[model samples]
Target: MARLAQVTSSRNREVVAGFDNYADAERAVDSLSDKGFPVEHTTISGVGLRLVEDVLGRLTYPKAAGLGAVNGLWIGLLFGVFLALFTTNAVAWFAVILWALLWGAVVGAVAALIWHALSGGRRDFLSASQLIADRYEVLVDPAHAERARELLQTSQS
Candidate 1:
Protein backbone atom coordinates (compact mmCIF):
# COMPACT_ATOMS: atom_id res chain seq x y z
CA MET A 1 0.00 0.00 0.00
CA ALA A 2 1.13 3.53 -0.77
CA ARG A 3 1.62 6.05 2.05
CA LEU A 4 1.46 9.83 1.86
CA ALA A 5 4.77 11.66 2.06
CA GLN A 6 5.44 13.98 4.98
CA VAL A 7 4.89 17.68 4.37
CA THR A 8 7.80 20.08 4.64
CA SER A 9 8.49 23.67 3.72
CA SER A 10 11.43 25.99 3.29
CA ARG A 11 11.95 29.26 5.19
CA ASN A 12 10.10 30.97 2.36
CA ARG A 13 6.80 29.53 3.65
CA GLU A 14 4.72 30.87 6.55
CA VAL A 15 2.01 29.25 8.63
CA VAL A 16 -1.44 30.83 8.44
CA ALA A 17 -3.27 28.80 11.07
CA GLY A 18 -2.96 25.54 12.97
CA PHE A 19 -6.38 23.88 12.76
CA ASP A 20 -7.63 20.79 14.48
CA ASN A 21 -9.40 19.59 11.37
CA TYR A 22 -9.01 19.70 7.60
CA ALA A 23 -12.31 21.51 7.13
CA ASP A 24 -11.18 24.47 9.24
CA ALA A 25 -7.91 24.73 7.35
CA GLU A 26 -9.77 24.51 4.04
CA ARG A 27 -12.13 27.25 5.17
CA ALA A 28 -9.18 29.52 5.96
CA VAL A 29 -7.88 29.09 2.42
CA ASP A 30 -11.33 29.69 1.00
CA SER A 31 -11.51 32.96 2.93
CA LEU A 32 -8.20 34.03 1.44
CA SER A 33 -9.47 33.24 -2.03
CA ASP A 34 -12.61 35.25 -1.43
CA LYS A 35 -10.52 38.26 -0.42
CA GLY A 36 -8.76 38.08 -3.80
CA PHE A 37 -5.56 36.79 -2.25
CA PRO A 38 -3.48 34.62 -4.61
CA VAL A 39 -4.85 31.27 -3.34
CA GLU A 40 -2.28 29.40 -5.45
CA HIS A 41 0.44 30.09 -2.88
CA THR A 42 -1.14 27.92 -0.20
CA THR A 43 -0.88 24.33 1.00
CA ILE A 44 -2.48 22.34 3.80
CA SER A 45 -0.31 20.00 5.85
CA GLY A 46 -1.48 17.25 8.19
CA VAL A 47 0.76 16.74 11.22
CA GLY A 48 0.98 14.58 14.34
CA LEU A 49 -0.99 11.72 12.85
CA ARG A 50 -1.88 8.19 13.86
CA LEU A 51 -3.68 5.38 12.16
CA VAL A 52 -7.18 4.61 13.49
CA GLU A 53 -8.84 1.28 12.91
CA ASP A 54 -12.62 1.13 13.25
CA VAL A 55 -14.75 -1.98 13.26
CA LEU A 56 -17.77 -1.63 11.00
CA GLY A 57 -19.75 -4.82 11.55
CA ARG A 58 -19.57 -8.49 12.39
CA LEU A 59 -19.31 -11.16 9.69
CA THR A 60 -21.63 -14.07 10.34
CA TYR A 61 -22.49 -17.26 8.52
CA PRO A 62 -25.80 -15.93 7.16
CA LYS A 63 -24.30 -12.62 6.03
CA ALA A 64 -21.35 -14.28 4.32
CA ALA A 65 -23.51 -16.83 2.61
CA GLY A 66 -25.93 -14.17 1.34
CA LEU A 67 -23.11 -12.00 0.05
CA GLY A 68 -21.55 -14.89 -1.78
CA ALA A 69 -24.84 -15.92 -3.32
CA VAL A 70 -25.51 -12.41 -4.64
CA ASN A 71 -22.06 -12.17 -6.15
CA GLY A 72 -22.40 -15.58 -7.78
CA LEU A 73 -25.78 -14.75 -9.21
CA TRP A 74 -24.37 -11.71 -11.02
CA ILE A 75 -21.43 -13.72 -12.37
CA GLY A 76 -23.73 -16.51 -13.53
CA LEU A 77 -26.03 -14.06 -15.29
CA LEU A 78 -23.10 -12.56 -17.16
CA PHE A 79 -21.77 -15.95 -18.15
CA GLY A 80 -25.17 -17.05 -19.41
CA VAL A 81 -25.52 -13.91 -21.49
CA PHE A 82 -22.11 -14.46 -23.02
CA LEU A 83 -22.98 -18.03 -23.93
CA ALA A 84 -26.28 -16.98 -25.42
CA LEU A 85 -24.51 -14.54 -27.73
CA PHE A 86 -22.96 -17.47 -29.67
CA THR A 87 -26.33 -19.16 -30.30
CA THR A 88 -29.50 -18.25 -32.19
CA ASN A 89 -32.20 -20.16 -30.26
CA ALA A 90 -34.10 -18.16 -27.59
CA VAL A 91 -35.14 -21.40 -25.72
CA ALA A 92 -31.49 -22.47 -25.37
CA TRP A 93 -30.54 -19.06 -23.95
CA PHE A 94 -33.14 -19.28 -21.15
CA ALA A 95 -32.15 -22.87 -20.38
CA VAL A 96 -28.47 -21.87 -20.01
CA ILE A 97 -29.34 -18.97 -17.73
CA LEU A 98 -31.52 -21.11 -15.45
CA TRP A 99 -28.92 -23.85 -15.21
CA ALA A 100 -26.15 -21.37 -14.47
CA LEU A 101 -28.17 -19.60 -11.75
CA LEU A 102 -29.00 -22.88 -9.94
CA TRP A 103 -25.44 -24.15 -9.98
CA GLY A 104 -23.98 -20.78 -9.13
CA ALA A 105 -26.17 -20.34 -6.06
CA VAL A 106 -25.35 -23.84 -4.77
CA VAL A 107 -21.60 -23.43 -5.36
CA GLY A 108 -21.51 -20.00 -3.78
CA ALA A 109 -23.38 -21.06 -0.65
CA VAL A 110 -21.19 -24.12 -0.09
CA ALA A 111 -17.94 -22.22 -0.70
CA ALA A 112 -18.86 -19.47 1.75
CA LEU A 113 -19.87 -21.99 4.44
CA ILE A 114 -16.58 -23.84 4.13
CA TRP A 115 -14.51 -20.65 4.16
CA HIS A 116 -16.32 -19.34 7.21
CA ALA A 117 -15.80 -22.61 9.05
CA LEU A 118 -12.07 -22.57 8.26
CA SER A 119 -11.72 -19.15 9.90
CA GLY A 120 -12.48 -20.78 13.31
CA GLY A 121 -14.12 -17.51 14.41
CA ARG A 122 -10.76 -15.77 14.77
CA ARG A 123 -11.56 -12.71 12.64
CA ASP A 124 -15.28 -12.33 12.10
CA PHE A 125 -15.74 -8.62 11.76
CA LEU A 126 -15.30 -5.96 9.08
CA SER A 127 -13.04 -3.01 9.81
CA ALA A 128 -11.75 0.14 8.16
CA SER A 129 -8.54 2.00 8.96
CA GLN A 130 -7.50 5.55 8.24
CA LEU A 131 -4.69 7.93 9.10
CA ILE A 132 -6.00 10.72 11.32
CA ALA A 133 -3.99 13.89 11.74
CA ASP A 134 -3.95 15.60 15.13
CA ARG A 135 -3.69 18.99 13.52
CA TYR A 136 -3.77 20.69 10.12
CA GLU A 137 -1.69 23.72 9.19
CA VAL A 138 -2.34 26.12 6.37
CA LEU A 139 0.84 27.45 4.84
CA VAL A 140 1.34 30.15 2.30
CA ASP A 141 4.26 31.74 0.45
CA PRO A 142 6.09 34.23 2.69
CA ALA A 143 5.18 37.17 0.51
CA HIS A 144 1.43 36.54 0.92
CA ALA A 145 1.37 35.10 4.41
CA GLU A 146 0.78 38.39 6.20
CA ARG A 147 -2.20 39.27 4.05
CA ALA A 148 -3.61 35.77 4.26
CA ARG A 149 -3.35 35.77 8.03
CA GLU A 150 -5.02 39.14 8.28
CA LEU A 151 -7.93 38.07 6.12
CA LEU A 152 -8.43 34.82 8.02
CA GLN A 153 -8.35 36.54 11.39
CA THR A 154 -10.88 39.16 10.27
CA SER A 155 -13.20 36.48 8.88
CA GLN A 156 -13.18 34.58 12.16
CA SER A 157 -14.09 37.71 14.11
Candidate 2:
Protein backbone atom coordinates (compact mmCIF):
# COMPACT_ATOMS: atom_id res chain seq x y z
CA MET A 1 0.00 0.00 0.00
CA ALA A 2 2.83 2.38 0.79
CA ARG A 3 4.46 1.62 -2.53
CA LEU A 4 1.25 2.37 -4.34
CA ALA A 5 0.94 5.60 -2.44
CA GLN A 6 4.46 6.58 -3.40
CA VAL A 7 3.84 5.92 -7.07
CA THR A 8 0.58 7.81 -6.96
CA SER A 9 2.16 10.71 -5.12
CA SER A 10 4.83 10.96 -7.76
CA ARG A 11 2.04 11.68 -10.20
CA ASN A 12 0.43 14.25 -7.94
CA ARG A 13 0.35 16.67 -10.84
CA GLU A 14 -1.87 14.21 -12.65
CA VAL A 15 -5.33 13.14 -11.60
CA VAL A 16 -6.95 9.80 -12.38
CA ALA A 17 -10.64 9.22 -12.83
CA GLY A 18 -12.18 5.82 -13.36
CA PHE A 19 -15.26 5.26 -15.47
CA ASP A 20 -17.87 2.54 -15.29
CA ASN A 21 -18.24 2.22 -19.07
CA TYR A 22 -16.45 3.19 -22.24
CA ALA A 23 -19.16 5.64 -23.25
CA ASP A 24 -18.75 7.60 -20.04
CA ALA A 25 -15.02 7.76 -20.51
CA GLU A 26 -15.48 8.94 -24.06
CA ARG A 27 -17.96 11.57 -22.98
CA ALA A 28 -15.55 12.88 -20.38
CA VAL A 29 -12.75 13.19 -22.91
CA ASP A 30 -15.00 14.91 -25.42
CA SER A 31 -16.27 17.33 -22.85
CA LEU A 32 -12.78 18.17 -21.64
CA SER A 33 -11.52 18.76 -25.15
CA ASP A 34 -14.48 21.00 -25.91
CA LYS A 35 -13.52 23.11 -22.89
CA GLY A 36 -10.05 23.57 -24.39
CA PHE A 37 -8.49 21.01 -22.07
CA PRO A 38 -6.02 18.55 -23.44
CA VAL A 39 -7.19 14.99 -22.94
CA GLU A 40 -5.36 11.88 -24.11
CA HIS A 41 -6.32 8.28 -23.52
CA THR A 42 -4.49 5.08 -24.28
CA THR A 43 -4.83 1.32 -24.02
CA ILE A 44 -1.99 -1.03 -23.24
CA SER A 45 -1.85 -4.82 -23.23
CA GLY A 46 -0.78 -6.86 -20.20
CA VAL A 47 2.04 -9.27 -20.98
CA GLY A 48 1.82 -11.10 -17.66
CA LEU A 49 -1.22 -13.05 -18.81
CA ARG A 50 0.51 -14.35 -21.91
CA LEU A 51 3.59 -15.32 -19.95
CA VAL A 52 1.58 -17.19 -17.31
CA GLU A 53 -0.41 -19.06 -19.97
CA ASP A 54 2.70 -20.07 -21.84
CA VAL A 55 4.27 -21.57 -18.74
CA LEU A 56 1.09 -23.30 -17.47
CA GLY A 57 0.12 -24.64 -20.86
CA ARG A 58 3.52 -26.17 -21.37
CA LEU A 59 3.52 -27.75 -17.91
CA THR A 60 -0.06 -29.05 -18.03
CA TYR A 61 -0.31 -30.05 -21.70
CA PRO A 62 3.16 -31.48 -22.15
CA LYS A 63 3.28 -35.03 -23.50
CA ALA A 64 5.91 -35.90 -20.88
CA ALA A 65 3.89 -34.41 -18.05
CA GLY A 66 1.75 -37.45 -17.42
CA LEU A 67 0.42 -40.68 -18.92
CA GLY A 68 -1.03 -38.46 -21.54
CA ALA A 69 -1.84 -34.85 -20.54
CA VAL A 70 -1.36 -34.59 -16.79
CA ASN A 71 1.37 -36.10 -14.63
CA GLY A 72 -1.12 -36.26 -11.76
CA LEU A 73 -3.60 -38.23 -13.82
CA TRP A 74 -1.91 -41.36 -12.58
CA ILE A 75 -2.86 -40.45 -9.04
CA GLY A 76 -6.46 -40.11 -10.14
CA LEU A 77 -6.14 -43.36 -12.02
CA LEU A 78 -4.90 -45.00 -8.85
CA PHE A 79 -7.83 -43.63 -6.91
CA GLY A 80 -10.13 -44.90 -9.63
CA VAL A 81 -8.53 -48.32 -9.45
CA PHE A 82 -9.02 -48.31 -5.70
CA LEU A 83 -12.67 -47.46 -6.21
CA ALA A 84 -13.03 -50.29 -8.71
CA LEU A 85 -11.11 -52.77 -6.57
CA PHE A 86 -12.95 -51.99 -3.34
CA THR A 87 -16.65 -51.80 -2.54
CA THR A 88 -18.75 -54.83 -3.47
CA ASN A 89 -20.94 -52.41 -5.48
CA ALA A 90 -18.92 -53.64 -8.51
CA VAL A 91 -18.11 -50.28 -10.16
CA ALA A 92 -16.34 -50.37 -13.52
CA TRP A 93 -12.83 -48.98 -13.72
CA PHE A 94 -13.90 -46.62 -16.50
CA ALA A 95 -16.61 -45.08 -14.28
CA VAL A 96 -14.08 -44.65 -11.49
CA ILE A 97 -11.65 -42.97 -13.89
CA LEU A 98 -14.39 -40.62 -15.07
CA TRP A 99 -15.16 -39.73 -11.49
CA ALA A 100 -11.48 -39.08 -10.88
CA LEU A 101 -11.35 -36.82 -13.90
CA LEU A 102 -14.32 -34.83 -12.60
CA TRP A 103 -12.60 -34.54 -9.23
CA GLY A 104 -9.40 -33.35 -10.92
CA ALA A 105 -11.35 -30.74 -12.90
CA VAL A 106 -12.94 -29.45 -9.72
CA VAL A 107 -9.56 -29.19 -8.07
CA GLY A 108 -8.15 -27.35 -11.04
CA ALA A 109 -11.09 -24.94 -11.03
CA VAL A 110 -10.57 -24.14 -7.36
CA ALA A 111 -6.87 -23.56 -7.85
CA ALA A 112 -7.53 -21.29 -10.81
CA LEU A 113 -10.05 -19.31 -8.80
CA ILE A 114 -7.55 -18.78 -6.00
CA TRP A 115 -4.83 -17.79 -8.44
CA HIS A 116 -7.10 -15.33 -10.23
CA ALA A 117 -8.15 -13.73 -6.97
CA LEU A 118 -4.54 -13.30 -5.90
CA SER A 119 -3.53 -11.69 -9.19
CA GLY A 120 -4.38 -8.00 -9.08
CA GLY A 121 -5.80 -5.56 -11.65
CA ARG A 122 -8.81 -5.71 -13.91
CA ARG A 123 -8.74 -9.02 -15.70
CA ASP A 124 -11.02 -11.26 -17.74
CA PHE A 125 -10.49 -14.67 -16.16
CA LEU A 126 -12.41 -16.30 -19.02
CA SER A 127 -9.11 -16.28 -20.90
CA ALA A 128 -6.18 -18.43 -19.87
CA SER A 129 -4.23 -15.25 -19.28
CA GLN A 130 -2.86 -13.69 -16.11
CA LEU A 131 -2.63 -10.07 -17.17
CA ILE A 132 -4.78 -7.43 -18.80
CA ALA A 133 -4.74 -7.30 -22.60
CA ASP A 134 -6.32 -3.87 -22.86
CA ARG A 135 -7.11 -0.82 -20.72
CA TYR A 136 -8.20 2.78 -21.15
CA GLU A 137 -5.78 5.24 -19.52
CA VAL A 138 -5.96 9.00 -19.67
CA LEU A 139 -3.48 11.83 -19.29
CA VAL A 140 -3.92 15.55 -19.04
CA ASP A 141 -1.59 18.49 -18.64
CA PRO A 142 -0.97 19.27 -14.98
CA ALA A 143 -2.68 22.63 -15.15
CA HIS A 144 -5.91 21.11 -16.47
CA ALA A 145 -5.77 17.78 -14.65
CA GLU A 146 -7.98 18.93 -11.80
CA ARG A 147 -10.80 20.18 -13.97
CA ALA A 148 -10.58 17.14 -16.20
CA ARG A 149 -10.62 14.80 -13.23
CA GLU A 150 -13.59 16.60 -11.71
CA LEU A 151 -15.53 16.48 -14.94
CA LEU A 152 -14.73 12.81 -15.45
CA GLN A 153 -15.65 11.98 -11.88
CA THR A 154 -18.94 13.80 -12.03
CA SER A 155 -19.78 12.15 -15.29
CA GLN A 156 -18.93 8.75 -13.92
CA SER A 157 -21.08 9.30 -10.84
TM-scores for the candidates: 0.57, 0.28
Model 1 per-residue lDDT tens digits across residues 1-157: 1222223443357888999999999988888888898987788888898999999899999988887787788878888788878767889889888878877777787788788889999889878999999999988888888888899989999
**Candidate-wise lDDT, in order:** 0.83, 0.51
Query: What's the TM for model 2?
Result: 0.28
In model 1, how large is the Cα lDDT of residue 22? 94
RMSD of 1: 5.3
- Model 1: ten consecutive residues of lowest lDDT: 1-10
**Best TM-score goes to which candidate?**
1
The deviation in Å at residue 43 for candidate 1 is 1.6
